[model samples]
Target: MRDAGESPLLVAADTFRAAAIEQLETWASRLDIPIVSGRPDGDPAAVVFDAINAANARGNSTVIADTAGRLHTKGHLMDELGKIVRVTGRAREGAPDEVLLVLDGTAGQNAIQQARQFTKDANVTGLVITKLDGTAKGGAVFAIVHELGLPVKYLGVGEKADDLVPMDARAFVDALLPRAA
Candidate 1:
């Protein structure tokens, strides 16, 4: 937000929000990114990036309700994708260092693809893939990193707080798709 000036909020999802909410609040108190969001009652990501920018501009941020998206038409899809790009950085007022975008890759294939798109279109600098126990294709990780041009910053190995781990590409390759030798 160019005009955003000193007012910038961090709108985050609910899955791992509890984990980051405190962090955002503490930082917002410092950087002034208003703690306007609690939990997305709906699919906050579905509202398109335009709405995100507008809401953050009005206040620090807003809790996008949980719900479905309207993307049956190509035009709608284009508009949605374009709007997300606008909010993330491409359309940032200054440089879009205000909000923190997060996506959880614990759902399914569609979710992984969605996360990939989020990274591709928005300012997604990292990813958090959850529930990756002893057996997971994780090929999806490579696909996401390479396809989205972003990094898998963290991985959710289990359903606990300590389960979260910073992603190490070399280690991941060695464990999942190591050398044939």
Candidate 2:
């Protein structure tokens, strides 16, 4: 979101985890971005609604909602994610222009399964592979694209916000399979 040069409002919609909200708040502060959060353990959809209103009122061009993470096996939690998407669209047409599913690069084949479920449940438009700077080759990226046919939008290389880089196929492949020394 920072790469777009648009003032983004971080919406802490991960009401299930206080640490998630705190983490988002920390990132917001570090990035000097505004944040909208609901009461502790409040409904995530309500927080999204409030965040959308705040973004419109504050004239923020983008609103990045940090939703709660749940296992793909959890049907109820997945349903809640769908609710969030619906609420977002109702709040503003075409609101979530991009629904990115953040996957752990280290998750390997497990990531593929997660993507499949998220794509179906949350209407995932793209992927954000995180922890790519580690030993994880992120080979599951190929499996995800091949099976789900969704594009990899971003890569979280490190802890810093700037470490989030755009997906470069050539670079990613080269990094994943380096030539013998």
Estimate the TM-score of every prediction.
0.46, 0.95
RMSD of each: 8.4, 1.3
Query: Over the stretch 1-181, how does candidate 1's per-residue lDDT look in tens digits?
Result: 3244534445443322345545545655765444444444433343334445566567643332211233223455535544544544443455444222334444445655565455544455666666676466466666666676666667777765457678877887777776877
Q: Put down candidate 2 lDDT per residue, 1-181, tens digits, no spaces.
A: 6566788899989988858888888988988999997767899999999899889999999989998889999999999999999999989998779899999999988898899999998899999999988898889989889988999999999998789999999999999888899
Q: What's the lDDT for all of these models?
A: 0.50, 0.90
Best by lDDT: 2
lDDT score, candidate 2, position 122 = 82
**C-alpha displacement of 15 in model 1, angstroms?**
11
CA displacement after TM-score superposition, residue 85 of candidate 1 (Å):
8.0
The C-alpha stretches of model 1 lying farther than 4 A from their native spots are 1-112, 178-181
Q: What's model 2's overall lDDT?
A: 0.90
Q: What is the Å distance of residue 146 in model 2 from its true position?
A: 1.3
